[model samples]
Target: MAEKIDRQEVQHVANLAKLSFDDQALSKITPQLEEIIGLFTDLQKVDTDGVEPMYSPTTEVNVMREDKGIRSNQREALLKNAPDTQDGLIKVPAIIDESEDGDK
Candidate 1:
């Protein structure tokens, strides 16, 4: 026999999850949710015994190759793509005001 869960319990869970339902919607869904939970409770009765836990069913290994640094010797080619460059570095707009110009 499966353990029975209350309809109100489902509503309480929904409330905790910040979900709102009309009285009609609640009435229709509560029994269905209870039935699903009841099915899960029924499944819990089945014994696994010596079943091994699997990360995935497939025995496939990672086909992707390791990251090989194949960087180009073309520094000028890379810097040419930048919108703004200063002192051989990519220049970006200030995220925060550290100090006003001529204040320091």
Candidate 2:
């Protein structure tokens, strides 16, 4: 059975999503929404008794490497490219206001 999506339901969904649609747009989108619901209803009739549930569509497995401590002496080389540095560390301008207490 095809489910019908009324203008009120569409408007309610729009309001939930913080969207505003005029009468023309609402009329146009209602049919599309109904069609999508009908497609889902059709999908409910499919049989998948022996099908395995998939977390992802692809069959790729993640290969993990053993954690080995290897240090590089590239700090001095990287520090040379920095635009601003302080006490052997990169310095950036403060973005947040620390003076403002949690009152706001």
Who wins the lDDT comparison?
A: 2
lDDT (tens digit, per residue) of candidate 2 on 1-104: 66678999999999999998999999899999998888889876879789887778877789888889789989989999999999999999887777665757
lDDT string, candidate 1, 19-97, tens digits: 9777898888878887887778876777988988777988888798888999788888899999999999899999766
Location of the lowest summed lDDT over 10 successive residues in candidate 2: 95-104
- Worst 10 contiguous positions by lDDT, candidate 1: 1-10
Q: Return the number of clashes found in candidate 2.
A: 0
Clashing residue pairs in candidate 2 (N, C-alpha, C atoms within 3 angstroms): none
| Candidate no. 1 TM-score | 0.42
